[model samples]
Target: MEAHRIFFERPFDYKYAREYSGTLMTPTLWITAAYVILVFGTKAYMKDRKPFDLRRPLQLWNLGLALYSGAAFLIATKEILSTWFNKGLTATYTDINSFYEGTCGAWAYLFMISKYYELGDTAFLVLRKRPLLLMHWLHHLTTLNLVLAGYHYDTHLYSWLLWMNTFIHTLMYSYYLLASCGYRLPAGFAKKITTMQIIQFCIGLSILAHIGVLKLFTDREVHCNWRMWWGTVFMEILYLTLFSHFYYVSYIKDGGKKFVRDQNEKKQVKAQ
Candidate 1:
């Protein structure tokens, strides 16, 4: 029990002790800027060039990410469950006013840092000359910002976000791994993945919306930062809209129609 508690504890006590708090947002901003440059620069360089055959590297990357996300999900679930069972900890953890006091704040910090690594997914896309849809990069950029801010602000809501996102990515990267390896699961498998992502956005939005209702309409004090809450709402709404568009374009508009058109073309070729 003692070993488990220590292992689950946040691993950054030195940063807290040294009070190098400015280190958080400073690097986050710099990295975000550099990421933008690198992405577009790569895109320009790849213009009119053959796409890299990154099938093997991509498969390895996806497999690694799937495992990493799975580990994060399990660790976070354990931390939450452990904290919830202790009476004193549970009260503070569940209290609206004391959200910043989660025992898992260190893990939240780790989650924020992991977002930087997640940028590699975009790097792979750019290298392969794959489409960088608005939904893809925007989601990455906005999520990095949100997680960075959430940690600095000690927004307790991010605990749930961390868990949900890690869980979704577990499934998502697994699908990516299989797809990259030239394996197709079923007819509607891809659509089902997008639908799951859309549902994730819905659940995230509802949590923030529930807080809004309590603060504005009800008599609750709702101790979280309203600014952060509004920021979350904006991010969630954008994600929901962009992902819905991607789904429409993929499964409904392009996917099904393209299949029919391909079949027609094949039939005409046969007749000729």
Candidate 2:
């Protein structure tokens, strides 16, 4: 019992978190609108100015997020394992208590709210004059929308999303943290991260399918709330398609040509 308490400590009011999620839905939409405008506005404002050298601040920002994601992953892992062992595999997805109770609940709420803070990633790109891809902003927007809807509807299926996202982000932000600090990471590192993101979306859809099967064939009460289910399905399919196209264009097609050309130039220089 003492050992269990260590892993399942409830430090926050879960009911209040749910209430807050419901109340914040409209405000979140408003904030997202403001975010879109600000992103384009910042880009226009910076068009005539030299890019700000924000390396140090960017390093600190990535470091902070890396740490947060790492910690969230650990907490989520413990909660997931505990539920799986004690309640069974189905409980991991169907248990609303798992979503709104104990340490996991608190961390999940933090994870949902973190979406708002993550808009800063785009701000960094805009201010630094980096090429902002559609995938980047669309990802932020869709994700914020999905998580808020999931929380408001108590979509327990999102427990899987919360866990998987935190795990991927732990790696993703750490990569950013290293690259920001002047580390010469492998050329394929970013490509590999994008590949992993593509894989993540595929796995998410697979989990949704698994829940769908259970709902259709079994009498077991599945919490596959349709309110968020269709939205989740649409977003996951869209992400998978977008990320796959990005990988093909950036790595397998144009990027492959660029890499080979750069390599040949290096070899010619060495030979001379």
Choose the strongest candidate by TM-score: 2
Q: In model 2, which range of ten residues has the least summed lDDT?
A: 1-10
Q: lDDT values of the candidates?
A: 0.70, 0.80
lDDT for model 2 comes to: 0.80
TM-score of each: 0.78, 0.88
Find the number of clashing residue pairs for candidate 1. Answer: 0
The Cα error of candidate 1 at residue 70, in Å, is: 0.6
Runs in model 1 deviating more than 4 A are 1-22, 81-106, 216-223, 258-272
lDDT of 1 by residue, 57-133 (tens): 99999998899789878877776665566533322222422223344445455577679889899988898776687
Candidate topping lDDT: 2
Q: What is the lDDT, from 0 to 100, of the residue 190 in candidate 2?
A: 74
Candidate 1 structure, TM-score to reference: 0.78
